[model samples]
Target: MTADRDTLPLPPLAPDMQAVMDRLMAEDGVQPDPTLLPPAEGRAKAEAANRRWNGPAPAMARELIVETPGGRRAFVFIPPSDTGREAILYIHGGGWAFCSAATHEGAARRLALATGAPVITFDYRLAPEHPYPAGLDDCLSLWAEREHILSGRRWSVSGDSAGANLALALMIRLKNRDLPHCGLLFYGVFDADFESPSYRQVADGPGLTRGKMQRYWDFYAPEERRSSDPCLTPARASDEVLAALPPLYLNAAEVDPLRSDSEALAARLHALGRKDPFDTVPGVVHGFMQMSIWLPQAEAAFDRAGEAFRTMT
Candidate 1:
C-alpha cells in the first residue's frame, strides 16, 4: 500500500553521499520497485547495483568458506597482522530477500579492519523463498557451531537492516543459553509499523521507501504473524527480553524510513533503565554504510561503530 507523504521534511543528503547516489542512479537507471520483480530478477538486479560500491577489496590475511548443512555458505575475513582473539559475526542485509556474503564482502572486510577482529558473514536463506524462521534458524545454526567455527575467540554480533533484525531475534532466542559480548545493529527494521513518523516522512524515497519495506515484510512474514511474532517484529518483544539483551550499539540513517525503529528501540531501552548507545548519522539515506568506499560519512560511521564495539562492556 502506498502511503501519503507526511509534511515532515527529510534531512538533506551529505554531498559525498549525494554524489555516490547519483552515480548509482546513472548506472542502474530508473529501476522498477523491488516487490514488482520476480525474486530471481530482484536478486540479480540488487547484486549488480551493489557491485560498484564494493570498490577495491582490502587485503585479508586469510579467507575461507565453511559449508554447512542445507548448502549454507559462510565467509570468514581474517585481517592482516595480529588483531586479537575477538571475532564478529556479521550478518548482511538485503531486506531479508536479496544480497549475500559476496555482496557484503567489502563491508565485512572493512569491519575486520576497523575492529581488528575476524568477521564472519554467511548466506542466510532469502525470503519469498525461505522466509521467517528459515533465515533465523540458519543464523542459530551458525551460532550453535561457533565453538568449532570461532576457535575459542570471544565474539560480538553485528548486522545491517534485515540482518540486524535477525541479529536481535537470534539474541532473544539465545537468552536462555549463552549470549554474545555485545550487539552492533545498524539501521535495523525492528517493527512492521510502516506508519511511524520516519516512514511517513520518507514514504516514497530517495532510498528505502515505505512501500518497498511493506513488500519486504509481506515477503518475510504473514500479516497475522508480524505483530505477534517477537522474532519477526522485535519492537514487539517484551520488556523482560529487551532488558536481557546484551550491551548494544544502535545507529540509524537520518533520512531513512526505518530511522524511528532505532529511535523507538533506543527510547524503550532508556525507559527500562538501560543506556545502550544510539546514533543517527545525518544527511544519509538508508543503508548508507554500503557506500563507505566513496562516502566519508559512511566510512566514519564504521569507525564509530567499531569504537563503540570496542568500548562496550
Candidate 2:
C-alpha cells in the first residue's frame, strides 16, 4: 500500500532535510519492518545510508567489543581535548530493532568533540528476537559492570528514539544502585499511549507514524505487558519514582510523532517539583540527531546535548 503523499501531514522539513526524507519515501519507508530483513542486513543498509548522510567520521573514534553479560559491541569516541572526568554512553535509535553503534557513530563523535569527553555507544540487543527485557538487560549489565568500562568517572546515558527509552529506563532501574548517571534523552518513547496529541497531529508521518510505532511497541513488549511495566512505559511512573530520577535533559523533535513523549516526561518531572530543561529542535523530525552531517538543526541539537552533558555531569 502506498500513502497519498500529496495529502500527508508531513513535517516542514528544511531544504537539506527534504532530500533525506525523499530518499526514505523513495525506499518505501512509510512503515518500519526490521523483522522482514535480518538485523545484520538492516544494520549494514542503515550504516551505508548513514555514511552518505553523515559525510565524514569523527577523527578519533573506534569500534570495540564489550563483554557485558549480553556480549554486545560498542563504539568509543575520544575528543582531542579530553578530560577524564566525564563520559557519555550513547545508545542508537532504530525503533529498538534496527540500526547499530556504527550507524550512529557520526553523531556520537560530534558529541564527543563538542563535550570534550569520551562517548561510548553500545550495540545492545534488539527486540522480537531478543525481546523486551533483553535489550534493557544488556544495558543494565553494562551499568552493573561500569567499573570495567570506566572506573571513577562520571558518566551519563544518552540515546535517540528507542535508545532514549533504554537510557531513561536504565536511570529508573539504577536509581538506587549508587551509579553516577544523569540522562540525556532525545525524542524518547516514554509511554505506551498511542493517542497523545503529537501522536494524533503527526500520526501519519513523512518519517514515523502512529501505526509504525505501535508495531515497535508490540515487538518490544506485547500489549499485555506494556501497560503494567513502567520500565516500558515511563510515563506511568509514580510521582515518587519520577522524583528519584537523576537530572534529565530532554530533547524532542518539534515535528515528530513522539514529540509528546518528551512533553509527557516533562510534565511528570514537573509534577514532582523537578525542573529539567526540555528543548525541541525546530523544523526536524525524529532521528534528527543522526543527520547532523547535513542538517544544521541536528548539529545544533548535538550542541545542546553536549552542553547538557557538561551541565549534568
**Best candidate per lDDT, number?**
1
Scored by TM-score, the top model is: 1
For model 2, the superposed segments whose C-alpha errors exceed 4 Å read 1-11, 23-48, 61-72
Question: After superposition, which runs of candidate 1 have C-alpha atoms over 4 Å from their true positions?
Answer: 1-6, 68-71
Steric clashes per prediction: 0, 0
lDDT of 2 by residue, 1-313 (tens): 1243334455576766787678667875554344456667765665666565555877874444455444555556778767878878887888887777767778788888878888888777777678888999888877767656666788878888999889888888876776546888889999877777778768876567788798788778889988777788888887777888888899899778899888988988887888788998777887888877667888788888778777777
> Model 2 residue 276 lDDT?
88
Query: Which 10 consecutive positions of candidate 1 have the poorest summed lDDT?
Result: 1-10
- Give the Å error, residue 35, model 1: 2.0
lDDT score for residue 292 of model 2? 74
